[model samples]
Target chain A: MPFGNLTYLVGLIVALLIYSAVGTVFRTLYLLLLSLGFLGYISPESLVILLLVSSLSYACYSGMRGQTNRSLWFFLGVAINLTGLFFFREFSIRESWSISSYSVEYALIAVGISFYSLQNLGVLIKEKLQPSAMTIPFTDFMLFSAFFPKIISGPLLRHENFLPQLSPDRNIDWVPGIQRILFGIVKKTVIADRLAYLVNHNFETVDPTGWNNLIVAHLFALQLYFDFSGYTDIALGSARLFGFKLTENFNFPLRATSITEFWRRWHISLTSWLRDFVYTPVAFGLRGSVLGILLAILITFALSGIWHGLALTFIIYACTHAAYLMGEFLLRDFRMKIKVVVGKSVFNLLGWFLTVNLVSISFLFFRSTSCIDALDRIGHVFSCSNFFPSNWKSGFIYKIAVGGDQQNIFNLSITLALTFTVLLAEKYVYRRLESNKIRVGLMVLFMVSIGLFGVFTDLDKFIYGQF
Target chain B: MDNLTQIEAVIRKVFKDDSLIIDAQTSADDIDGWDSLTHLQIITEIEKHFSVKFTLSELLDVNTVGDIDRIIQQKFA
Candidate 1:
């Protein structure tokens, strides 16, 4: 079920209450069952696939113990997980390779394999390298794999960090968890869903005008940021209610002054995963060389793009990011020289401006239906006839949003205002406001805002849910 | 120099922060500008100074200065 669903919210509350009251011995099992139910509720086939994969991994783990060729078993485990991920993500009923009815059915029903495969691989690699660092009990491992909160889109957990926290003796911090959930609801429903209205219009326009492309480019970035991070907040909050802590996935990535810094902040878990497992390994032989760095970045990002899906648009998206990072690194000395000339404040302002636009422009590929579609939209930007922001005051907002209605304007205004409010608070206000009363007031405001402005009728699934 | 002292010097040189202190427990999280790219530079410098090549597994396994030191000492042995 979508985290934004009312039923999911009610279910979360019930689960949290039961979890808190249950004894330590039963707590883990209760959560494991809840997770199975959540997944089984959505796609029973997916739960079966998850169990099969988990069982295979456990069998491999058992085989590796006290064995001479532990590496063989470890690699087999990795290969199995990778095979499962690729098969689910790539295979379809339309493909000629769908030899049987069962293959077609399983391909269609597979869910969250993208996320759980990474989690499973992490355990295999970490345990192989560390050798008996933590002997995870079977139930704890199962729960780690199927934890309902982060199973969909993750603040992807590492074995060392997550496994240790599965103890029954953990204490619950009730208030902050509820506050986080409320904040997430406001972020997802009140802010992100509203922005999705305009963004969806922009995506649908076959012949986007220059102004349309330009405006929606930035809006899409904001829409995605709020949507994914909003989902994260709920996931973290839900896990928090159960006294389990997940790694944070975002750190105000939009404010990053450089693409390098942006990747460090944005989708931190996935980037770090690529860094540890993909980039580091590939770059090892090529370390301490400029060309090597560039090459490694290219390969890693290409893999990252492929991980999202096997599509030309995603490939272009990946290449664009690889190019950005490569360009950023190549010009580091130049940037430093310019920084010296311009002074830090001016330099940073310029960097922020360039980074934001570059990042936004790259999202064109990510949001496009195909590479040609993305290029067509970008082609609008260079057309001399559509150069000026011509439609301003007459129907600029209407053109961008594709509607001139009172309700549309209201939703757009609230989205823009809330977006800025959230940024400003995260950057400035929230840190300084240590008062519990004020914090509680803000929580209540969030609840009120959701009740008032939340777009409940046409709820958009979290954008990252497809991944 | 001992492994820690040598590592400290290499880190300071690579990061261009001579004032930076170092210890066995020091890791990427503890240092500024010690991101993935600069990390390779530090490792290369250490390899050059010690005349030892680290395997990919060894590199992956090294989380802190202590891990690096232990690996280097093992190589020497």
Candidate 2:
């Protein structure tokens, strides 16, 4: 079940209560059962697959515990988990192979298989690398891999970072937990869903003009950020209640001055994971050669693209970023010299402008249905007829006028005000509210605002869950 | 020049900062242009200057100047 559902909230509360009453000795088993039940609620078939994958991973690790060919075991573990991920995600391939319909049906319902398999593979790799340091019990590994909050979409927990926090002696922290969940709800319902209306409308437009397409791209970027990061907040908050501290996923990514800095700040866990697992290894193998470095980046990002999906658009999106990063790498000396020529503030402003626009432009591919659609939209962005604002007044006013029923202008005004309120809250108010009473008040206020202004009809699913 | 001085010169030249003074505790955060890109450049320059190669793990594990110094010492010893 999606975290946004009322039933899921009820389930969460009931689970927490039961967890609080359970003894420390049974805590691991309790959490493991809770995670399994959570997955079962989504799909019994998925739950079985998860259990199988987890069991296979645990057995592989156990077999490799004292083995001399630990690396071989690690490769085997990775291959098994990756095969599971590939089978579930690529239904077309299964169909082509004439796989049994029952297995295909099972694959279709496998929701968190991608995320959990990666988590399991990470554990196996770590164990192989430092066997002595990663001696956790099988139950601990199960709990770590299948932890409900992070199993679906993740702050991609490393075993080293997550396992130590699973000790039975930890106490639940309620204040920050509730605060984060409430904040996530507000961000999702108020900001992301509200922006989704405009984004969906404009992106679906067959012949969007220059400013219109640009505005749509920017809104899509914002919508994506709020949607994914909002889910992350809920996940982190839920995990916190269970006394687990998942890694923070986003750190105000929109404010980054460069794409490189943006990666460091955005989807931080995945970026670091790819860096550690893919980029570093490739770069290391190609050390002391610029061509090797470039190839490593290309391979890493292509894999990142493939990880998202097998779509051509995702590949373009990843390639666009790789190009930008490589360009930055090649132009480091020039950038430094430019920084020396210009003042730091001006340099930063220039960097921010270029970085944000480049990122927004690249995301056109990510948001588009296909490469052809994205290219057509990009072409429209530069067409001579669309460059002027002559047609913008009527179009813009109509879009914000709520179906063009009345030109009262109140809807547009309210949208701008609400957008600013969400931005201000994210930037300032949310961080400054420290006292428990004040946090509770803000939570109530946020709930009331969401009730009043949230786009409840045709609610868009969290964007990153697909990946 | 010794390893430290030679490494310092390589860092300064790569970063285009002549006034750089790096000690054991110095890290990427202490310098303006010491990002991952420049980091590779610095490593490459060091390897070329010292005629020593670093493994991928060693490159990843080196976080601070002190780590670099130690690795270089071990390589040359």
Candidate 3:
């Protein structure tokens, strides 16, 4: 067997055995073996990095357990690991040198390192923060970080809430947990994967010369949302299956009435993290003064941009959002006054329009590679004014969507109907339906649509997965 | 009508709502401006007014201006 396959199978067998046995010592030993086995399979440098990270994670764990200064050893370990990885990936691997930049093979996988690092560091920080709140033992904390379902792409676990649950107090309700996993399976396999086909096709070959690119962008936007949200659903559900309840990552974000609300709904855990740890602190730091507020917004968004990547496109995207948010803040009181004067419907429509367009514009940033790439795409959408995509003309579905080599009434009808149904279901219909029968019905329908029309296939990981 | 006057003043100033008036029994429902985000602002402001810092649990447990006043009195007394 290949080394990767052999290690993977062994890790799973050991974990399953330990998991079935269910003891602190057994689980910890299994995980340690798993980590070592994982390291054994990878490159020597990565193995070294893994050892360093494991040491850091363990230090953070021990620090939280002991209620000390979070093990400077742990902090040093994590900082060195991250900084070193960053240097290796950014400078050396990209350029091709050892000291002078050459890591030729170029496949530097830091997969799950960030998740583990953040979860552990968050544990250390939260321990330093609350001291008495409660800390899970080193074994539980390590396992929580390494939990197979979320280790790779996470609902980005944080330890503050995760720790207390790890103790014996948690009551694992297997029925609902299993049900959640079922929902996730449906979402990932049915809807997300289905949508992935069209979305991937559109983005991979979006031509800037005509109106086809515009249609492609719109398709990509919806595709990206489903792809990311679908992965989150699966992760959350999978966590539930294992008796650990992970947080929801999406809450009908596309149905949000405003940009602020949209953010609160989309990738909810990450947004919450940004708000609580990043946005709030920065915003609060700038507390009383307008300049302080400006500085806070700038810093928060810049950090968000950096979190996405070191790309100019990401930076511009963040800046565009910052500009809109500032404008929204400045105009908040004025808009309220407008609502009083222009009537509720007008005000709401305006707010929703601003939100949708703002999101659409920023998503373009998320999609594009560089500022120029983004700008060229935007130019094509707004200025090209002609030439529909020819590929979409092939299938009846494609014809119905973008056109017979152009836009179609059927596609618009379907999109509008689906969009309307989702909005009503999220907003009103779900609230009215209190019966299990109805919910099951809805789920069945959701599954059917996802299975039939959803996108999936060679999906890149979730947008937040990179962070 | 007691130190409710002082506490309400702090609440109004913190929420930037000069028109807000509340009695001992008044809840956040009766006080329109008092939402969770602003509620924290109110607690922090109340803490500043009384020169006291609220622990996270204490802040989490509070629901009203009177609760704020009582916590303050208990702490400072």
Off by over 4 Å in 1: A93-107, A206-209, A382-385, A405-407, A427-438, A458-460, B1-9, B12-32, B61-77
Instruction: Give candidate 1's error at residue A111 in angstroms.
Output: 1.8
TM-score of each candidate structure, all chains considered together: 0.91, 0.91, 0.73
**Predicted candidate 3 versus true structure: per-residue lDDT over A1-467, tens digit per residue:** 11112243344445555555676535445544565554445445555655566566666556546635556644664575457446544433322211111122345655556556556555554554455544455556556656655655567777655655454434434445434444444444444444444445455544645565555555556656655665665555444433566766777777655665676677676666665555655555445455656666667778667655556777888888777766666565676578779898887788777676568757777776556766777776667444555454453345324444333544455554654455455434324332223356656665686566443333323444444
lDDT of 3: 0.56
Order candidates by lDDT, high to low.
1, 2, 3
Question: Which digits, one per residue and each the tens of the lDDT, describe model 1 over residues A50-104?
Answer: 9988878877776677567788889889988988888866664224221111122
On lDDT, the stronger of 2 and 3 is 2
- Residue A140, candidate 3: Cα error in Å is 1.6
Question: What fnat does each of the candidate structures reach?
Answer: 0.68, 0.26, 0.00
User: Judged by DockQ cut-offs, is candidate 2 incorrect, acceptable, medium or high?
Assistant: acceptable
Clashes of 3: 19
User: Each prediction's DockQ?
Assistant: 0.58, 0.45, 0.20
